[model samples]
Target: MRRALGVVALGVLVTGCVGPRPAAPVATAIVAPPAWRTALGPGSPVRAEWWNAFGDPVLTRLVAEALANNPDLGIAAGRVDEARAAERLARAQLSPTVSVGVPTTDSRALNAFGTASTNLTATPSITASYDPDLFGRLRNASAAARAQLLASEGARDVVRLAIASSVASGYITLRALDARLAVARDTLAARGDALRIARRRAETGYTSNLELHQAEGEYRATEQLIPQAQLAITRQEDALSLLLGATPRAIGRGAALTALVLPPIPDGLPADLLRRRPDLFQAEQTLVAADRSLDSARAALLPNIALTGSAGVILTTALANPVGIFSLGGSVLSPLFDGGRLRANVDLTVARRDQAAFSYRRSALTAFREVDDSLAGVQRSGEQAVAIRGQRDAYAAALRNASNRYRAGYSSYLDQLDTQRGLLTAELALVQANADRLTSYVALYQAMGGGWTEADVAAVRR
Candidate 1:
């Protein structure tokens, strides 16, 4: 009865058995506009498989393969599973633990009357113990674990988006290399024909040796490009192989550079965009977990309460054959002095929570910046491609006119050479511009967080 009174007195001292409660974190208020500052084209919302915008079957297949086979994504998936297991462990703490045990022994002893006696004894017992969550410590820990699990899942989605975008960009570059290689070979063939004409003119005494030598130099210069381009193609194929987690092998071809088109995209509000990105979700979940951890740390300052009980039976070959025993008890442990460990823990949690909040805000700002930068890249690359195309056409016309004048002995060989070089340079630039435009589209899609979604993860889990 005195112990019971002590418990009541302590409860009264600790605010009626609940102790002090920590305040919940306030909601962060964010304002976003209706649309992005960058100019947007007319289109529908981006689909989960945004790579389909390219309309290339080969590209679509490559992206699918990368997503299925990439090791980084596999690692992220494993982290999700690990976090889920931790959550289960935290939740298990809320339940009581009960165990049963049985022990048996045979004993031979001499009694006080000088008679030897043998007896068999058995004792069976059941023990149970439970820690009540009077101060919400267990509940907060479980909540924090749940938040960590969600954060891991979001991190997996972030990896998925990166893999998809990388596959698309690599595929575009490989195709561009193929187009550029074709241009180089065609130029080499044209140079061969011009070299033969120059040799014929020199043999007939119509052109000097200097002109013939210049023609030979130009022909060899163009010839060297074919081997250089082939090397680039090999290296690009190797890079793409690594992305797909495959060995260095021949990469498949896709649509020609000229046949490709940039898919349209609609610029949604910043708030909606933020919701779509997995990285942002990850940051937010991390902050939630940090807040819960802070709550748990504060709860540690209160008292810990537990209840214990046990029941047993004893049996023996004697007059008082069987016996039963039962007992019950409770405990309360309050923190009086701990060298300031509890206060240090609380301070540490607060610091971590503040860091998470800052990280979340930074992620939001970076996401918006990525979207804007990609938008600008797409627009500028498209304009550059158009200008380069016009320049290539004019160079082609000039080459034709220069060749005609040279055949009629009206202009020098230098005119034809200059025009030919200009045309080749313009063509190569156009190919690069096309590649840049396609990759910019890829970046925009990734920034918009249109690749994978929660459904994809659920399917994988199932």
Candidate 2:
């Protein structure tokens, strides 16, 4: 028996010298551009609280509220907590386990004398077991769990960035609707004055019924716009309320759409996106976890070594004094044959690791595209707003000339009506263009990662 045990121990020692396979190499296929296609030289660094750049206290407050109370964020936090617990469990595997137990028994039996007697036995023991990690399997598993924890944290930050962006964009739309409503009401009031003037001219016989009817029709056409604008405002308010995670209700007003500050474009190179975006960070961490998991699976093929020990005190009705007992043992469980189950596990981990690598590549490419798209939007929208503003000014001047010509009997009412229509259309277009410009900035900020960084995550972890 001793010779056989020595041979087994020798084989285990030899196997232990050959450790787990080295980690496989993973590579990302995507490449970032040298510079942004719409690069506007260096600008201000993106602030962590990017919404503050808009200089609207109400908008800032809304974003804060959404971050704190949003259900999606809460769910994300819960996932993070779960990951933390899993990490703890994995780490526990690296340490020895100790337990204590007490057991008591009573029995009645006939002895040699044929006498029935009751005897009670009580045994209390403390045991300890340890896995001497000769192959680093437990260490790799612990590392994998730690990587998963970081990935969960990154996912949480991604949700946080998304919620802030949504709140800002929703607020911008609400304010634009407010501006449209104001323009509609102002135009209706002006048309009402023109209708009164035409009535007086017709009664004095200075104008024909054709001119009087035309003015009244124009006034009514403008009147309908007020109701349309009000309806849109109500819908927009409700939408903003939802983003605030509150029941549909009236939203408070802040700076007018035109008065709101246009934040400076955030500046960063395309390659920086890898570290700036939380989604990208999450993807990278997921890959790391897969790599560690693969290592652990490979390590499973090696021999497992365990050491166990126990110490106990026994008390019995027949014993004169308490008895002490102790035991020590060691084991080696090497997978000599398992129908290739261990190798199959390694293959499965390899496949999953490759999948994670591809996922990371996809995420990096997507981040690059989003930044480029947002940059173009910010530039093109600003240019459109400029052109629309100039057009609005020209239409306003023409309306003044047309109104005077009709009142002085030099032109027909049709000429005044055409100019009025052009001016109103220009005003509405200008409002939309301005709103688009502001919202483009919001998209740019979001696409640029909303000032999220891997360093921030590390700081929180610490």
Measured on C-alpha atoms, candidate 1 has an lDDT of: 0.79
For candidate 2, lDDT tens digit of each residue in 189-291?
8888888989999999998988889989989998898888877877776666666566555666678898899875423333443355677778988999999
Runs of candidate 2 exceeding 4 Å displacement: 1-47, 201-214, 266-270, 336-340, 452-462
TM-score of 1: 0.84
How many backbone clashes does every candidate have? 0, 0
What lDDT does candidate 1 reach at residue 155? 87
Residues 1-462, candidate 1, lDDT per residue (tens digit)? 111111111222333463322231121222111221111112212344678778886777777767766788779889989999999999999999899988998989998999999888888999999999898888999999999998998888788778888888888888888899999989988888889989999999999988899999999998888888888877887776666666566677768877777786543323344456778878988999999999999999999999999999998886486899888999999899999999999999999999999999888888777777777788889999999999999999999999999889999999999999999999999999999999998997787676434443343235
Instruction: Identify the runs in model 1 with alpha carbons over 4 angstroms from their true place.
Output: 1-47, 104-108, 267-271, 319-321, 451-462
lDDT scores of the candidates, listed in order: 0.79, 0.78
Can you give the lDDT of residue 435 in candidate 2? 87
In Å, residue 301's CA in model 2 sits off its true spot by 2.7
The global Cα lDDT (0 to 1) of model 2 is 0.78
User: What TM-score, computed on C-alpha atoms, does each candidate reach?
Assistant: 0.84, 0.82
How high a TM-score does candidate 2 get?
A: 0.82
